[model samples]
Target: IMRWNKNIRLSCAYLFRIKYNGKYLLVKGNRIDQYQPIGGVYKYYASFNELKTKLEIEDEEEINFYEEGDLRQITKGKYLEKFLDWFDTKKNREVTVIRELIEELHIGEISIEQLIKSMQIEYLKTVKEEIKFSKHFQVDELKIFNIYEVRIPDETLAEIINNDKYSLVEAGEINKLCFMKKGLSTKISETSKYII
Candidate 1:
């Protein structure tokens, strides 16, 4: 059970880094109302219910109805390394990035069916953020981000970036948590730096 004095978040996320014209593409976040990388939290499969129950993992209630079973959850701090170990096995979890990309980019089935050949996806880096007190959520956040570099054709990228829901930040302008708007000095998203 989550206690009032201590709250620990153990969650994993995968993010995509797409670049065009020296600018990286960032999409508006659903929960925080800020620009972030085109990605979401990993999800545990139904078969993991045994462990979920054992761990007393609670379903995410902050997001919409569809995000009921994502891999994001809060628990005791003692389960920190154990959670990452279970996640490294890559079993009983959503491992593919296709689902998130299709959801965030709104790609058609035809376009997605042929994406593998036209798109070059590779693991970029993994960032492990130490448990720290968050003033916004009023809890200690422990997060791991599996960042991937997704390379697509310039034409398709331009088309996707045209959407108002997306923002462009230059490579140099990216700070630890925020980035300046393309050709401007406006900053957005404190957590977007993880994608870099």
Candidate 2:
């Protein structure tokens, strides 16, 4: 899933090249419950060389569910071009951006790129305990890295450490993807940052 504010018309797709059992696995999803591809957002390493390393680690950690095989990206270059346009211009809401990803990149069924994007989106939705919430729920928290103050804590962050390793998810606050997009008027202001 991808997130761009309401002002930007952009889409994000998780691209994956996998060969398992001689058959490729593709993931797809929508607002409704269903299976989607697996993968996370890339904050750095926009180039293919750098992205490949990020993809490798993610594949080993998450995409490994798919049959074993070589990994590659069928969707090359301009991977974030469409989304960047909106992200650079309008400053859209993170949730809206992810929703747009659900609407645009979901082709026929699920794919690696879609899956990674979806996973990254889900990871970012997690909130910290200090944040207050009207309701209590359990969700896994995903960490984000700021290039300026990059450091690794005891826990492994969902975010990529090296730009050469993975692309970073644009949303850092983790507040944007907190609420479930059940409808158009879904208000997340009251929700705790910790709720995913």
Candidate 3:
């Protein structure tokens, strides 16, 4: 059985399957030990402007607003629209995925242009009309998880390890680089088999 939260709103996440030498890349955040995919939550509205009239600002000049239940309902459509825009932009997907890889895992050798040229996008699956519950909040998300595979040479992998952007811990110590296949999971707010 699934629990429902009345405060549910839409959210988007990306799951990258960065494969090298047969295994896929898995990352554990600085604060946690459990490894997940190399992705993060995509914030639909970085600022109040993106919300437009959906979110009522008390002060139109300063964009002051109270955080409450009604605000979630009002902004649900904006979140859904942002996710739909992401879904429709195929080329943007490749670029954003590549940028995220570089930012998260420090996979810097591959450029956006090169990835756009050589990357293979496998539309894994979609989870529509699902409500994900957490301790902090609940989200009714149309989550789409896709796998991106790119082959990198040994030297480039070494470069990633030496870079400052690669900061993941493994085995109670800082790991230069590591890849695994079994424990790989998506960056969804809720745990589901669709991610695998």
For residues 128-187, could you state the per-residue lDDT of candidate 1 as single tens digits? 887788675577888788999999888777767777788888755567456555554554
- Per-residue lDDT of candidate 3, residues 1-196 (tens digit): 1312133343344665454544444555544444555664432333334433444222112122212211223234334445355445542223244556556644557655644555455545444544444343333334444444445555555555455323323322213223332465323122222233
lDDT (CA) per prediction: 0.74, 0.27, 0.41
TM-score of 1: 0.84
Q: Arrange candidates, best TM-score first.
A: 1, 3, 2
TM-score of 3: 0.48
CA RMSD, predictions in order:
3.5, 20.1, 9.0
Q: At residue 105, give the lDDT of candidate 3.
A: 46
TM-scores vs. true structure, each candidate? 0.84, 0.19, 0.48
* Candidate number with the higher TM-score (1 or 3): 1
lDDT (C-alpha) at residue 36 in model 1: 77
Query: Could you tell which candidate, 1 or 2, scores higher by lDDT?
Result: 1
lDDT of 2 by residue, 25-93 (tens): 222232323222233233223333454353222322234222222121222123334423433342322
